[model samples]
Target: MIETYSIWNLHGEQVDHASSSNAPRVDNVKPIVDPNDQVMGIIQDVFPFASTNINQEGEDDVPTPIDSAEFEQYKKLLKNVNQELYPGCESFSVLTAIVELMHGKIKYRMSNLCFDYFLGVFKRMLPTDNCLPKDHKHAQKMLHGLGLGYEKIHACKNNCMLFYKEHETLDTCPICNESRFKMTSQNRTTKIPQKVMRYLPLKPRLQRLYMSTHTATDMR
Candidate 1:
């Protein structure tokens, strides 16, 4: 017989065991699974955009520039993980949850600012598991609109919120109504204080969504 292990959710609220006998435990947390109760592998740690780039000795390097290829790869990786680990989660909910995990307490403010940067473009981008095709014309348009073309955006360790240029202005989100939100930035980086921002708080809806999606998957 194969040995099994228990997996923990993001909140550390509950534990689910692995379906496969071969799953390994790194940190306490494991990846989400499907309804059929199979081990989908664990959620890979969210790759920080800042770590991808290297600076010359004594030279400062900002976050790696956002390119279409990298963005598409990020999306596919996210989608695959979602399908295996968090099956029932709406794409938006999953993305929001990941963003929340990335940003932690500052999700709201980051959401507001990011919402503004794309003129609310994120609203439409939501509910998508990063599976959009690379050649999709809309993707290019969206990237261009966000000023993401050839520019780098970094996620703050505090809340997973993304930052482009420091001290920027936000207008409107193309996807959601502007009246539903408010925005701000909390700079937390000591070295690049101006360039960094924190993550936002997880809203009640998101919390519920996360719980509902992972509760059952934990059992297998």
Candidate 2:
């Protein structure tokens, strides 16, 4: 059976005359998705792609060998994460806790100082053997190592353009003539971007999809 899709403008009006090759320059074309089609998968809960080779120990049964440097780095991280903080609790558990709390803080628009204070409390209350970081900066380092982080890019506050590529070093927005950074206090020297955009690296994430046998087969 043949299925058709509609092109919609920004105002939610259907553009009957909008063709892929002949659509007007001013009219933006957004293709309406088909609910029955796999063109876009069903929206559901966020989950890690399941692997058939996952062992009873909740680890990947098939270990992909890496270079000595990478192996050592993984070994170090494993050591830090596997440490028994207090009886049944491993240091990795604390890391997950920090991750969940940070996720909630961002999701709920909680205060940064509040989150840092909570982390400080965890550090003080938990066993000294626990590998939980002291603050968001250290937590970010651990998350980045685990491939769960994003890159920050500076952008124009008015959304005129991104401060990327050839525009990377510019101090002001060429289109709007607006300052790229906000005015800071005389005592402070750090130049903070007027606005920032978070970007997730695609390479590692794409590789991870193929690691799952089902996802790999589906992709093919």
Candidate 3:
């Protein structure tokens, strides 16, 4: 891995800069389904946008970047796993609940019946007695397989513009009367961000080409 430093020639003063993807967790992205175009399609179907400042008229109506054909490719990829596997059920809620029980702190003691029920249902889902993939582990595997996801930048709450290189200094949203921060206390009183724009990163693509077993050393 490459390393970087910020302390300079004169006074050793340094400004810190860091970034990360702000997309929702895989579970929250759309429960039990693969984090592919299908999730976008389903979400957009359920909650169709009632006009948006972010796009030209009716542009937001078509949500996913891929057309119908590419989506069918993904749908076909799952047929071997379950011939009857419908579009809505890629993963299992049993796994989701089991994962939640494992990660979260419990108030009740050793013999929780609901927890036992979750484990029982989860065990039943396995084809054999030996093994099953954990939800979070599978999520990590999917994330790594995707190479990387998208990072986000703050946006105007009114959708006037994105607060990027040119508009990073604005305090309030210029288009609307809304303040950039929340109206409540705590971080809201400070200069906290309210909205964001998620976009895919290019650096991970370059890194993946270098790291990929199939592509490394074949620069062209």
Among all candidates shown, the one with the greatest TM-score:
2
Off by over 4 Å in 2: 1-72, 87-111, 127-130, 185-189, 212-220
**What overall lDDT goes with each candidate model?**
0.38, 0.63, 0.48
Better of 2 and 3 by TM-score: 2
Off by over 4 Å in 1: 1-74, 77-85, 91-93, 107-220
RMSD to the hidden true structure, all candidates: 23.9, 16.5, 29.0
Worst 10 residues of 2 by lDDT: 38-47
Ranking by lDDT: 2, 3, 1
Question: Which of the predicted structures, 2 or 3, would earn the higher lDDT when compared with the native?
Answer: 2
In angstroms, the error of model 3 at 27 is 39
lDDT tens digits, residues 15-116, model 1? 444643466666876766442222122222122351334567856567556677656756654454354223354533332333323343255454534434
Q: Candidate 1: TM-score?
A: 0.16
Error of 1 at 2 (Å): 89
Q: Ten consecutive residues with minimal summed lDDT in candidate 3?
A: 42-51
lDDT of 2 by residue, 1-220 (tens): 2245444455677666635557447767788743222101211001222113478998777644446655554544444444444556722344455555677889988787887888889789987776668887777665444444578989999999999999999999999999999999988889889899999999877765665444777767
lDDT, candidate 3, 1-220, per-residue tens:
2245323424665444332335555544545555333333332332223113256664545543555643454443332223212234445332233333444425454344555565556657755532333343442332231224687788878788887787777777777756766666764545667898898888867766665434667955
Model 3: lDDT of residue 108 = 51
